[model samples]
Target: MSRLSDMLRTQRFDDYRFYHQSTINQTLHLISAIIFLGCYALLFTDAAIAGIVGWLAMLTRQTGHFFFEPNGYDAVNDVSNDYKEAVKVGYNQTRKIILLLVWGSAPVALYVYPTLFGLFDPPTDRFDFVRHVGTLWLAIGIGGGLARMLQLFATRDLTTGLVWAFKVLTDPFHNIALYWKSPLKLLRGELIDSSIADADWGADEVEEAPHLT
Candidate 1:
């Protein structure tokens, strides 16, 4: 009982709380979910329209990762009081943005076919448009979904990853479907310490940046 209390009281965890999914960010998630669902529906009805919405949603949804961001430093108050600490935070922020642009943007290009919205229609007679649409969504849901599963590594929380996969499997776009370490890490400034030196103390406990989730 005492150990459990100690664990609960540990300073590593914070008193931080988050609003329900009705909040603006969560609402955006809902909007993205609806769009993806609609895209799926349309993908079957007409490949051209489905491609347009899919690509558009892919662009808009992913682009927002940069526009709607809160510096994560606030989640963990800095006690370092060292001059270098603030500088480190500044450097980290810039790095995070760059990473979001590069590694995180792969899906945008990978799914560009859907994004193009049938600008260059794959010949209907030769190409099975419905097959293409289904393939794209399935790829995003399963293939990209697996990649997103890898992202749980950024959280360093295995259980959290499992739960996240279970929740977002049906809705890929809304889920961020990649382990976006930079954005979430920058938001919270929490990252896994991989230095061999730190391992001497003990294998670090699996930690998560809850705020980003």
Candidate 2:
């Protein structure tokens, strides 16, 4: 338990220090986190609505990473952007692009093949088509996470895989807790998270970063 807890903290700290150094990005994550919570609530009752809401949150979160966050030599962390991407435990930019392409293709594929090559029943109307898309999206989201988790199990270790999966699952609540002050900081014209420089994580004690496989 202690080891799991420590690794979780390290991963979260690294994520914030390495990736989320922009106030705008942090603020967007806050909004995304809230929307994710809504998606979570709708998950059991309406999978279709849950999938749509979940993707909306994901768009906000990824927009921050793709557009707002700095992707240069990270002076604060003393590492190059390439180095960070290589060591990222979860989806790096390259992997994210592939996942997003698959996600984007699902709707188009559904549009062309209404029954999705017999995977789903033919839609009766536009609303049904959208519902089918959402259901397929929900499946894709789950399958993507599980596929990565299994990959990690083969590449890293069981504990690392499980910990990353747990972190992903609980990120919404955690993001709210971590980035709630980001909007105020953005309002104050602080574009970057200056405090990140001082967030020392005992460099000698913790692993420098996760090993890429």
**Clash pairs for candidate 2:** none
Query: Where is the poorest 10-residue window by lDDT in model 1?
Result: 13-22
Candidate 1 has a TM-score of 0.37
Each candidate's TM vs. the true structure? 0.37, 0.96
With candidate 1 superimposed using the best TM-score fit, by how many Å does residue 75's alpha carbon deviate from the native? Answer: 4.8
- Most lDDT-accurate candidate: 2
Model 1, 1-213: lDDT tens digits are: 554333232211221111111122333444565677777788677755565566555545444334442333332233222322232311133444553454344435435554346533453542454445534544443455465456654644554455445544354442333222323443564332112113221122223222333
- Colliding residue pairs in candidate 1: 52-117, 55-115, 72-187, 72-188, 151-179
Evaluate residue 55 in candidate 1 and report its C-alpha lDDT on the 0 to 100 scale: 53
Q: Give the per-residue lDDT of model 2 (tens digit) for 1-213.
A: 978988888888889898999999999999999999999999989999799889989889999999999999999888999999998988889988988999999999999999998998989999999898889888888899999999989999998889999999999999999999999999999999999887775553245785667
Model 1 RMSD, rounded to 1 decimal: 12.7
Q: What is the lDDT of residue 210 in candidate 1?
A: 29
